[model samples]
Target: MPTVDPTVLERPVKLHHLTFLDEGEEMTVGRPDIDAYVHLPRDGAELLKRLADGDTPEQAAAWYAEAYGETVDMSDFLETLEELEFLADDDTEVTTAEPVRWQRLGAALFSRWGLAAVTLIVVAAGIVLTQRPDLIPHYSHAFYTPSLIVVMLTLFLGQFPFLFLHEGAHALAGRKLGLKSRLRVSRRFYFIVFETSMDGLVSVPRGKRYVPILAGVISDLTATALLIIVAASTGGLIAGVSMALALGTAMRILWQCYFFLRTDLYYLTVTVLGCKNLHATSRDLLLRRLRRLFGRPVGEPISATETDRRAARWYSWLLLLGYAVMIFSLGYVVVPSLVFVVGEVVDRIIEQAPLPLLLDSVVVAVLIVGQFVVAGLLGLRERRLNRTVSSQPKAGSR
Candidate 1:
């Protein structure tokens, strides 16, 4: 084990530029350069502030003791900071973060005029939908073509551009606030999803964080509105394609409501409730309850804030509901779709249908099955990778 030097308490402390945001009785302190953040009690935040402001660890600890009538272990605190990479070593150069690209565009989109324009578009779309309710999204919209292959291909292939737009909205929103973000492919349960990682958002004030978090949802709504208008104004295959796109986008919007999956709205809920680690805390709470019910030995008590523990009591029920919904969706939606496609394909093959007709059925079947196969392979690969990474030795450890 790596040991902390006793002399660290006597040395003057240096730190990279840090951002601090007050969250009720606690404060969030983070170094954006490293994208590391932690919640600390008000007293702890004050002590760290003093240390960063040129006070040696000893002096900061003495002040904390006098102010709070409790002496803190400065050595331990210094060690924790070192682990978080918040401390700046004298020999190490501190580099500034590069400016994020498209920041001006991000700023414009979130500005008052930009938001007003979106509001107008949404209102206009609503009026159009009211006049032409046929444009509304329905599962039937997905089958706009006679050929199942064309429908499947269009829906499958077309969703990526919208997905990119959705995730890009999130990235742009974060960039507006000078926070960097990156997009990556990830899995949500068995479904592959694109996600934007904006780790530096923790350093941003709570109120300003919502735009970045909800930007994707807003983008979805905008896309759906635009497509609905197109479908209403146009006819033939163009209208059909637009309707299909609208349906896909609308479904993506609905997916956000699965808050238990730690979706964007989930983070918004956590922020609104002023709860930290609610999902993990609720999961652990639920597991412990299940263990106790079966008279099994529950592990150690969960370490979480009182707010998180209190919220978890109710949030745990939502987690169960979320899982139930996932299962229900699989049975109600996925199974039926698979059965229909397979039955159709089998009928076409058995009857020795026309070459074009038979080829379409075969392609649809392969595409449908291939999606699940890819998802399964990706899931297994991610699980093994996670295991390997977890098994590796952490820094400063043997």
Candidate 2:
């Protein structure tokens, strides 16, 4: 093994490694992280080398497919490279030095009037809906598309802010527990996600675990309620859309709970399990299934990543089921809207109820079902991370 230069970006670096095949020419692999490149498997490595030398993911995928005479999904290459921080501006910023603005405010507010604020929002929404029954329906009908757009954008763009609030909760809880806390961005499933470095978090007694786990939700609930209130007051199409958007966004935030994808809820559950690394174990289990399907020899034995993945595995299966439901839901909800989107082009060639729409719905439904299945399977992984804290209650830090 050779040590790599840490600062080796901005130019091509190369390294020669043993090929996956024993009878191999010098195989070259490019490591964007260390900026080292290597060529092996002659032709295969040549293509890979070209990809590493700055070909876009699309180019790389095409090269792999064309050279190997196999269809290579670009997503795998792109996702891996992106997660490895291979893209330009790849480094995600990590923060812990300065306190997040909302945490400071939420702490004081939560300590003081968190309940009152929530009550006011609920009361206000109820009164508005009751007093002006015609309003919501009118708004829902009039600017539904714009409203939906706003909601979807909120779902996409607000992820960062929401994530921040989550880590803030962790930091706040850490503060309460007298532990220093910092926020860092780490790659997960090809995306950057915020997390509280558990170095300090883990060192603290297990009784304090719930604070960090529950912090993000507290932040989400508060932000959502406040946004809803603010959106409610504004009157007009924009205001109406705002209100709907806030509610929809809030629901998306809450959607985290329905699945166990490394969520706060899953972590909380894990702390109760006292089983470290349950996720890794469950992942092994999943891979074993894949191997069986492919007739490949079984590789590694299962260990643990944590109970969270196991819980998430259950959720994955549920999501797969949702796909089955989505078959219907897509026909009912998503597809109709999509029809309005491209109905003009489709209407020309197809019949009154275009086969495209039905086909699209079916595809979407299958996708939804697949998601549920994956979630269910991942949920079963059971990282057993928190099991180490078995001396404490299994009910959680509470």
Candidate 3:
């Protein structure tokens, strides 16, 4: 390991917004621009602070000895920081850019006042739902009478905007914290997911990160609350429409439980635990354990960093719990609901509603087929990118 010279440590390094967040049990050193962070002990943080303030190794070491009555390993400490790429020489340049326009918009939408309004609406909605309990949506509520086909079609189409709003909430949360974020569509198997990349959230204080991570869930819950309120107040067509939306939003909220899919709740757990690579590392660990349990001739598992290993050891249990919940939901919730819908559609066809039945069948078929089509396209793109990368000649090759 390379170590910083005691003489050069006197010079200050150019750093991004370096801040220490006291997280009660621990402290976090964060660099917002790079989205890099590490937890540190109080003394370790003080060491870095001293170095950042242009204290030479010898000076800092003396101060540490006087304060703690023990010698600090300045050489190893500097090497660790260097390895983490937290150190830069005087020539290193730091750049700044104007904040994105969306930051202001996010501030407006997710302001304290806005959150309070959402809370009030939710409370009012809850009271209304308790009073007019019939307004509460059930799975069968998806059938808007006369034609279940139209109700299914409307729900299938209407959810797109709500899903967008869910991702938008994530983007807004990150933006409100002055972090650049992007919204994109991704998929896990046949399930479509709207995601926001807020990698910069890692650089923020751990407490501050919970809001961004949980913002999507909040948005879903709030939308469902508003829908229930509207359904209670209105009747006829509006009530039907609102009830459909309410069911859609409620399902979306429940879907957050599949934390194995790296849902909002998954990110929230990762943030709370201060885990660096829990998802991938814990998944690998779980696979290895499963192989061993099944007496499979598994190859040697790739080793993870000590930090990752520690996090994975605990996080693997959460993955197991997620799998159990997913299976139960599929068997009890999803399968039963799907069977009821299919049976209803078939019953409608036999009752001489052939045209509506055909339309509903087509809608279901298109959605099922569309998900596979999208997955295939994504797979092809990934393969193409891999080929492009692999075909490139080595740097030293002629």
Candidate 4:
């Protein structure tokens, strides 16, 4: 622990947003400004509150000792606080303006009525799908008229616009809460995903945070519902394309279940549990288990932080289950689909005329090869990140 001057009082730190959460058996300190938080003991929380309210480290420590019959380690506590960025220095400047340009548009679209209307559409779509089971989209429906390759290409191209809207839904939801957001393209394994960064949502209440977290899913699901409805109501090429859109959007909605990727639902769980670092804690737990299974050295599985341990005890199982599901999917769905696509592409190329074959093969090859190249790039990036993180010291370590 670094030495502290007993005579010089540490300055009180001001945070963008501060909230105390009670978890029946524990207390958590939430700092939304920096999208960070820490779990503390009852006494520790009280001491922090005092410090935040302008009490000097010495004064807070003295008060804590009087109440708990033991002296608090001010040096270690302050260091930990600083490491977490809970203690803001003079150099820290808070940005007050909403940075995103589409703030007003977003808020209006995700408002209470907007959500209510979406809910109504989903319910209506469910009714239609149940009543007319024939309307439920199948892969065969997409390939019924056009050649499978052409239909696949068309559907793939169509999703580009919807993908933007999906991410925009998240940004809009954040805007409704006076938070700004940005859209970025990110990769999850080999899959390219459009994402919205709404870290500012942390500043909002936990209950309100659900809106932005779930907004993209809501958008995708809604699109699925609308497209399915259109497909059922119409016939011919329109119906086929609508069915394709419906299936594509529906799959995207289910894709969120990949919680191992820190998907939307993962963030929601983190907020609800008041967990500061569930992902890292759960990942560490998995590593410890793997080490033990493989006869390698295993350290503590639980986190050094009490709150993290509490969240991890339960959440770690979900992470394990997610991994299991992913492996199952790779075998059951992904591998077979890849094999089928490659076979179809080869067959089409062989069956077509010279000029047509060259054009069609190039298109199919680009789609398949592009996915593999992206996967390779992401794998390398993950390796680099793993190495960097491994070099850094773990939190709460002396």
Candidate with top TM-score is 1
- In order, what lDDT does every prediction score? 0.87, 0.50, 0.75, 0.75
Name the candidate, 1 or 4, with the larger lDDT value.
1
For model 4, name the residue pairs that clash. Answer: none
Worst window of 10 by summed lDDT in candidate 2: 14-23
Work out the TM-score per prediction: 0.91, 0.43, 0.71, 0.79
Candidate 4 Cα deviation (angstroms), residue 61 = 1.6
lDDT per residue for candidate 2 within 1-398, as digits (tens), equals: 22323233224323222122221333323332232222234655455556546665456557777878887544444333343333443344321233334455445544536546656765675566676554342324324454433444444454566677667767776665444556765433322356676444444345667656666776666655555555556666555555554554465466556333465665676567753444445555666766888999987654333344555466445544544564776578655755554554355336655676555544544443444455444444323433555644332110
- Candidate 1 or 2, higher lDDT? 1
Model 3: lowest-lDDT 10 consecutive positions: 389-398
Better of 2 and 4 by TM-score: 4
Greater-lDDT candidate between 3 and 4: 3
Give lDDT tens digits, candidate 3, residues 81-103.
65555776567764433466688
Q: Give per-residue lDDT, candidate 1, residue 299.
A: 96
lDDT of 4 at 36: 60
Q: Which rank order by lDDT, best down to worst?
A: 1, 3, 4, 2
